[model samples]
Target: MFKRIFNNQQPISLKWKWGILLFVTLTLFGFFSSLIYQQNALNIQLNQIQANHQYFFEAAINYLESMDEPIQRTHFQSVLDEANNNDLNNTHDSTLEFLTYFESNDIVYRFFNEKQQLVYETQHINLNPVEYSDSLKRMDVNNQMALVGSTKIISENTGESVGSFQYIVMPQLFDDIKSQMQNNLYVILIGIILFALAISFLLIRLFLRPLTYLVNSLDLVEAESLSQLRVRKPRSTDEWSDLSDHINRLLDKIDNYVKHQKQFVEDVSHELRTPVAIVEGHLTMLNRWGKEDPEILEESISASLQEITRMKGLVQEMLDLMRADHVDIDYKDEITEVYSTIRQVFNNFVMLYPEFQFYLDIESDPDELYVKVFRNHFEQIFIILLDNAVKYSTDRKEIHVALSTSVTAIRVAVQDFGEGMSVEDKDRVFGRFYRVDKARSRDKGGNGLGLSIAQQLVKSYRGEIWADSVLHHGSIFYVEFPILSDTRQIYKSKQIAKHKSL
Candidate 1:
């Protein structure tokens, strides 16, 4: 039954739910409060009635006790009858006057003889006398409830017991007061429920306004319109505002990623088109005349092979660039000595370019200069820099490799007296497929992907790499990496030595 009333298919709104909860709570509180008030008020009135009964009983007993002789039951009966008749005659009223007097006074007197036989009771049309009991009790009189208090009448002169007297009170006045209080409480409960419902609705709307705006803004975002989409700032500087700011930042990152991806596709297609076209031309020549002519066949096959090799190198470098983004994840535990890696690359370059002079300088201990990086990648980055230095140098015919240490990082620099780049070229030298001198780069088999890959790898290791160059004098490429702590280096060396022994 409860589920049917509060069905999930048509769930109650937050505003209505809160309002109903508060209303029910207040209703229960008001009901209990009213019940307590009624109980206390009735108790107070009952206490006052009891006190009045005690006073009247004492007054009647005192009047009888002051008699000169022992009072008989007949004398008490005559006293009560005479008092009722005199009061009625003085008011110039009938039996109705006597009834009204007893009702207003809220008490009725009754007297019994010593033998407990016949007694005197206030005259009333619906009066019903009951057999006396020891304790105070309620009795039914004319279909109405009455509280009865009784006491024995004693003669002080004879020290003997006389008849008993009782006072009966109706509690109709207290009942009326309780009924009025219940009615007032009902009216107050209804008013509070209506007010709570209205306020709850208004508060819910106010609190949810920002959320509604966020939903609407999200709906406006589509693939085609992502770059143009923006979320509006809320007026309040609260958690809602902070949420909107974070969402906007996420949107900006996604927009940049999408743009870069599209550009990457276009650049790849352009770069491959020339090599593919050259290969096609060679195949066509071979198919037409090179098959019959030995010289033509030889030249065509050589040209095709060169273009295929260039395309293969280009694709490999592109893969390297893509992989650089996640290099840290792949080689997080790999550590290498910076001086050793640079020394290895320098030695290989010297062997390959025997005519050029290679100089090296190491100012830090090799073991203490350890960095978090893959060994092969560390060698590759320096090799790319040295290769570029060799290709671009015009006058000096000499290369300088330097490794130094700071408090926090290891710095490696490769300086060459090369044909240095202009300010504009320096800014874009790290872009994929960008070259300062296209003819020279092509002749040296440069695909312009080396420096870009080096930069990305350096970034993955939380390092920085940049070039300092002038237009004609020289260029120096510097890379800095945060050095591993001495404790870590020593621990890693011990672990490596342990594994080798095993």
Candidate 2:
């Protein structure tokens, strides 16, 4: 499970982001280290000098004391050489070595005693300085000058003067000093680079995370629907939030456009075909008989007239349907006389197809049985359903239409014992231009817009239409509309025009 969760499809950006982070970290560390190295080097040199001052002072004093004691020249020279070299041969160095170690960077040596001056002064001269002045200055209480009294010439072993001994010290730059500093700075720089890279990688990951989420989310999605492509968003006040909003808006526009395109096609087909059929139908009828045959001409003319009628109905229904879609109807709604409307529509349907059996069950009086509806809308609804029943009935079969009241609304059910529709056909029956028996509908001369227009008109008055059917069994269409009271004033308004006509 963990392996699957961390799949091997890491984004290219993640690697590059982390790489840049490392580079910046290393650069920063290097910069700081270089800064400290120069300072630390100066401090180290200062420490060395302070330490040398103490050691060198002791070494100078010891050389002065040795010269003060008279000693044999050769024997004294050997002891002075040991002190100057700072290399005592015992397990530990002697006190002389510790004293002379201060002058290790320069030269330190002890000469033969001053009493042996006869030969030594002629043979040896110490390095550095114009001279180790025989009268070097010292301070008195009144700042008066005096000779450095301890450095005076002395005897050898017999306490006779040989010569004066001197100790010299100088400063030298250590050969590896710069190299050590450079090495320290180099390690610091590397460490800085690594640290910077880590931080930079993290920042890049954070900045691009929303975009990456959108991309990875798309990868995981396995769908073509608009809803499926929606990505979860980050909760940050940043540019990423703006981008997410834009993406969602784009998807919404795409979905709306697709829906409109489908509707446009359906509307165009429903609107255009009826007129085209009328024209072609008339032309075909004339071509078949050429106006010479009277009977054929009558039949052709009648057929053309029927087509024209159907086309006119299609145009009117189109206008009504569009209005219903785009505008709210403001006409009055009330507990209309649903039974009377059914009786009237059923009579018209049977008059048009008298061979068919039609019956109604209006179980309530007009006052008690009202469906809140616009009269024109109910009329159209009644016509469309009855027309469909008559058209689809194969054996001129019976139609069962019943009107009843529910607690909140009225239901007017019309059942046709005809060549019934399939479950699929019933589902989309109200969609524009959808026809189950296309051949029959076309021959009967309909543009396939009646049921859709009826549905739209019904909904304009806040009603519902649905159908139930099996393949072989007959179909039943149920239309439910609102019920309303306060009919006394409405009855007076309805009777005014009728009374005037009478």
Candidate 3:
């Protein structure tokens, strides 16, 4: 995600963010739907189990109704006695026997005849599977609790047809009720999931609306033609609107700045040239026609010479800076042995600034080494800094030159033990036409563009230059460029060391 943010060029749009939101919301919806669906299936199974239990309950009631009911108190007393006496047996056998009583109408009567010479049985019910159970029997619905029902049947003891009755009872149905409850739970959860999806869709659209408008406005813009751009007023004051307004203001400032720069260049040049031309014109006339008049000739010639020379020096410095500014430079990078380049620059400086004592420090590399850059540009950069050191040193007496190359880059530093500049002045030293001590600059003819031009030239070859100095101690100018690969760090440092030593 951080890489995505770092590398993306286009500004984010509302539509794209909206689409991501939609996709994530739908994914959550689908995830929850599957969860709900699984729960639903479980609920259905639960309901089926409850339904099976309800059928078993109804069957139990049907079997009970096949028994005879006790009516008279004496007869009821017999049943009470039987229930009391057989309570232990009833605990185990009655529930199972009750199901079998459904098969024969005479079974209960036969039991009574064999035991006590008593009453009748009403009817038989087959314990077959019914609608809710795995059986085919019809369930008795109207008299579910009616433990006995009348039936036409013959009692063999009476030898006549008669109305008879029977009953057996039990009352609970848990399984099917539990299943219905589970189905209800499933229905509720599905509703909640659908509701969440609806809310999510609304949230996504609300979050993305403003960004969409901003994108639509941006898409309508054309490059190289900001005149056609119309920054539509945003409905809300947000960061996006602030960004747009800021950009428009910046564009306006840039437009005006470029116009002013061109005008300043032309106006300053033409204005300075006019006075120079007028002074030279009068000097030429005096020298040509009044040569016999020695005083006029000498005075005219000297004044003319000074102005022309001043103009010439000023124009030359300006040209050098301009050339530095607009160069189409390519560093013809090769294995440039730094020891050789540094020695070459150092020798040239020592010869030119003869009065200054330059202390050389070129650390030896056991293997031959070179930096990957144009040697000429590197040498020129060093020469400019060395010249500055010589020019500003206290009466041109003390200077230091140091050179070293590492695995990654090469550094050349020239230090001057001179009256150093103040902190405020050091910051502006590399700016064109900036001077630290103007009085000293005039005496030395120090063109203020030298360091600026040198910096520009160094930067063209992918190198850097900077000055480090204090108010009293000294100033050190350092320049560095990348090192060459496959060049051994162990030098033939002495091979070139001997040349510079001489």
Candidate 4:
């Protein structure tokens, strides 16, 4: 039974668990508290019995010493009657409690001469002989717990022992008080445990209500409803509300990723279909009749090989796109100086297109501008823009490259006097497999993924990329990255280590 209740896999409700814990804790506390209270109460009663017994012993001894006759039982009775009447008539409330043992036979005493002959005693109880002590001792007498004390009676005149006095106080009032307290303690503990359990259950449920709602909301979410479903946030600004917000944000990302995956598959399939069909047509022609004629066979084989090359290039670019999506993870803690990389790529481009006019502009402090990007990937961003500029240039054949900086960012611009784009094309130029002029783009050997790859790479580095163009006039593509500062010198150190490893 204990194993089942505590099993981790088959967990119980938090409210009941807390309730049980509180119940046990409070029960133990109440039990110990009752024990302490009962002990104190019994001690107080015992002390009072001892004090009254001492008073009687002294009074009886004084009465015997005052007499000119020998001590007798009658003299002790007179002392007891006088003590009772005196306590009854006392106006002070303090002395009134002395009447319980004084007025009744509940307190019995025995007096013996120094030779051990009994001189006086009450007949109700026969207490066994006990050694004399300063404090009263509790012991069983006649099957009842009693306060017992023995003391020597001394003569005031000579300071000599005349007799010995012993007392056995049943203290029925003390016994009755103990019994009542025991019963009351049991009732109080049971009531306290029950009340504590109830309160704990209520409090636990109240505190966990938000979590319960969150769990229920999560249960309702299905893959199909991800885009439309949202967890309801609590009104209070607490950890539970923060949790709801995080879950909602996570769902949004999942929905977007699913949509992007679907679009990526569709775009790849559509792009592949045309080339696949071209290859298929050529193969079918060669098998049917083109194989018989050398010219036709050569033409079919050339077209098929060209299409196959294009397909291979498409596959390679798709792989690059995939890598661009994970650039942050693949190239973590990478940093580069802006000027050196730009100069190198520009010089290469100038050498490749020596006939075309090229211009370089540097508006920022090139030595000071640094950004967080792998040197190779950083160079790739500019290469794509420059190559696009070269591919789409008009008769002017002039390209411009500029490096500048803002307070927070390093900016690079690549401008070309090319066959520019319409507004619709400009808006969608960074979309996967998009092109303004499809036939012209294919004729120029453009797969339309260059700008998309650049965009993804820039976004992965927490940067931005965009283009502005006028139809038939020209286009300017811009890239921006946040510059690293003194506080982030750690990245530079990391870059040094990375280069050493390489």
- By lDDT, the best candidate is 4
In model 2, the worst 10-residue window by lDDT is: 141-150
Ranking by lDDT: 4, 1, 2, 3
What are the clashing pairs of model 1? none
* Model 3 per-residue lDDT tens digits across residues 242-300: 86687667656565546545653764475457547867686667757877888887777
Clashes of 2: 28
TM per candidate comes to: 0.69, 0.44, 0.45, 0.75
- Candidate 1, residue 101: lDDT: 45
| Local accuracy of candidate 2 as per-residue lDDT tens digits, 236-287 | 8678888888877887777776775588677777667766786687778788
Model 3 TM-score relative to the real fold: 0.45
Q: Model 4 misses residue 466 by how many Å?
A: 3.1
Query: What does the lDDT read for residue 11 in candidate 3?
Result: 61
* Lowest summed lDDT window (length 10), candidate 4: 92-101
The lDDT per prediction is 0.77, 0.64, 0.59, 0.79
lDDT of 4 at 214: 74
Q: What's model 2's overall lDDT? A: 0.64
Assess candidate 4 and give its lDDT.
0.79
lDDT string for model 1 (1-502, tens) is: 4585567666665556665676567667766776687678777876776666666556656655544443345654444575667753555323234344444545666656666644555534344555554344666665665677666667777767766666666556545655776787678667656755666566667877787787788888854489998788888899999999998999898988788678778888988999899999989988887799989888888988998999999999999999998998877767887766777788899899989999998885555467888888998899899999999999789999998888899899999998899999999999888899999998899998899999999999999999999998889999999988877664776587568569
Candidate 2, position 499, lDDT? 70
Between 3 and 4, whose TM-score is larger? 4
Q: TM-score: which is higher, 2 or 3?
A: 3
Task: Report the C-alpha lDDT of model 4 over 147-209, residue by residue, as the tens digit.
Answer: 777767666677677777676677575677678878877887788778777776787787788
The Cα error of candidate 4 at residue 234, in Å, is 1.4
